[model samples]
Target: MLRTYFPLSFISTLILLISTCAYAEDHTDELHSATTQVTGFGTLGIAHSTTSQADIVRDLSQRSGVGASGRTSLALDSNFGLQLDQRINENTDAAIQLLARKADKDFVPELTWLYAAYTPNDRLKLRLGRVGFDAYMLADSRQVAYSYTWVRPPVDFFGSLIVSYFDGADAVLSFQDAQQGNYQVKLYAGFARGKSYTGHADYDFSLDGSRILGGHLAYQRGAWSARLGYSQLLVKNEYSSLVPVLDAFHTAPLATLIPDAAQLSAELGMQNKRIRYLSAGLVYDAGPLQVQAMFSQTSTNSLNFPDSYAAFLSASYRMGKWTPYATLSASRPVSAQIPLQPPANAPAELVQLYKDLNDGIHSQRNRQSTLSLGLRYDLSDASNLKLQIDRIHSREKFLVRKEAPDWNGQTMLLSASYNFVF
Candidate 1:
């Protein structure tokens, strides 16, 4: 078996930190007022995609998530997650999180997080293991639906990348100023390996020893907070299955439209693809109203997957136990094109096929310019009920060349979820 894994450095560092933190915490507890506590949080959500030809998933990483297409036989938007935290002492803690989610008709349980965190001083804290590098405002709290207004985070923004964690270390800095607001920043590096959906099927890829470096900066004052973040993860992707797609381009009528198919393959799939992401957002939470807006972009050198951008504005008004919210989101691919100049004698159908291939480039995107309105009622402090409806458009296509493409459509979706924390 060709079993690939992260270098043991990430794992070994984790063991050392866990042992150090636990011992330090336990030793301090005997003489001081330090204590340990356990905590948990999660959500139960369901969504209905109204278009029979389209499946509306919460994020691109979800394999079997919800949609109206034939997938109606399944409810894809639902998921459950649990987290455990053990405080070794006032300055140290160990944590683990487990999530069970549906992917392509199967429910799989996986460990989402495992780490030990230590605060050496009031301003500095360090963490080691599998930890999320914040790409957005609520990036770390995304799985907790009750913390947000919508049925789900705007997919247009959050769905831009599937890989959230890297096996490594992070240093967090927080500064407090009497004259100014609070400032916080996080810096991290590690290797990220995972199976991500490429061309509709899951493809496995590793960091190839390239380090992942990223961080976020934030300022908070009273009821307002603003944040900006950027990250770069260079992936030398190996697309073994895509070899056939690149091979077929060399023969027959298709060759005319794509003369340098091999070059295109190298540009899109072969190696040295640096995936860079940028995001900025602001939030205002005061009185009975909560308002926020976010803008995000993913840049890379992949012809098949061009650079993408998204942004959204959301507002919610809280009325006792009832909260109503509205959101406007947009997503699109930039410089998404397939060069083509068919000979005049070429059959009309062949030319159309060429055009379809160009269209298919952006069709890989699942969300665009959506509007959502929803209401929420607190079932209790630990749980709440949400009912939401999204007006969405679909331009999805099959990734494999063999299957015929799906026509575009639009629909209104209904969603309901119950979120909890204990």
Candidate 2:
């Protein structure tokens, strides 16, 4: 089924998908004899940016398809996803999820997760194939807006890090709480590939790596819950940012001054690199009030590409079917100076080249802070409408980043969406 949003039909767009699924499910229940089940989640969103310099995107891998200086766009915030779950037996099961989204204003649908699971015992479960990284409290539920209060999880914690799927295996161990809370520990190992978003378009090569490993420990007791996770990956950054730069220099006078400078400096762009991530979070949801906070860090083995950290806190009060919430989030790069500083008296061309390499290394240093307030209204058992506005401030022209120098360093975003699950 298709949910189209014409000027007037936008109101119906929010409920169309959910209503369609609900109707189908109600009819199927009468003849329900299949072991397999199908379910879905979707969102219809309209958003605008005050900066008009860049679009607010879901994550680093995604470009809003508008902005970087444009009035408004729809390719940035609309998405649809479907899942199929099949139970082969008491011990075996399989599940798959596919998400349709726009990357750089164009449709680039991909598989979110697909795996076969085996439960041999009550406490231990094994899964193999493509699966989500258990990075945070809501990593797996990123697409399901109804599962969380935010229109999207904070970009600092979720968007900065790119690795989301692993083509490997995992084991989860479950245990009873010592007193009140229950516990679960998950360990995974695999290989993965990540595509790079060069602001408005994709780069020539994606980040491919091997020997990816991670583990997560979580505890929950009634209204209180906490989790900590860590993961490391051995990556080969083969995107080759040096070739074109070096080729341009071949005919320049600078080539004679510095021999094979581009090739020597190319390592600054990073290849055969290692990546590590650490994250922790706590949540409380009891009665009418809810609170949540999380912190995450991303680092790499190379000196050129250093580290970044982000943290955010949020609270919301539930009043009947409406939940009004506020959140504060901040992200900053642990910026580092390049070790190879050019001579002060060097030629202007040479000096600019050095600056180019230095800036390239610390490009992620655009620090940002955000304050957002929103209200969510439940429309039905499986659908809700959300209205949110965010004030964004940045230290540099980094965020709302574009392939070109389009970041205006500050912006405001107003958004509305209808989210549903069925």
Per-residue CA lDDT of model 2 for 1-422, tens digit only, reads: 12232333333443554575576688775424567777888777777777655556667666443455355656456777777788889899899987666543244457778999999999999999999876677886777887788776776557666666778999999998668678999999998755655322323336566568889999999999999999887766554655466456556665676766565545445566677889999999999999999998878755445577889999999999999999999987776445456655788878888787666555545367889999999988999999988787766333345534645467787878888887
Candidate 2 residue 311 C-alpha distance from true site, Å: 0.5
Evaluated with TM-score, which candidate comes out highest? 2
Q: Which stretches of candidate 1 lie over 4 Å from their true place?
A: 1-36, 68-75, 198-211, 247-262, 336-360, 365-367, 395-406
TM-score of 1: 0.80
So what's the TM-score on candidate 2?
Answer: 0.86
Per-residue alpha-carbon lDDT of candidate 1 for residues 10-111, written as tens digits (9 for 90 to 100): 345435444645565466655244344434555556555555555555665555344433433323444455565777977998888765555433435567
Clashes of 2: 4
**After superposing candidate 2, which stretches have Cα over 4 Å from the reference?**
1-27, 30-32, 198-205, 208-211, 245-267, 336-340, 403-408
Q: Count the backbone clashes (under 3 Å) in each candidate.
A: 7, 4
lDDT of each: 0.67, 0.71
RMSD of each: 7.8, 4.4
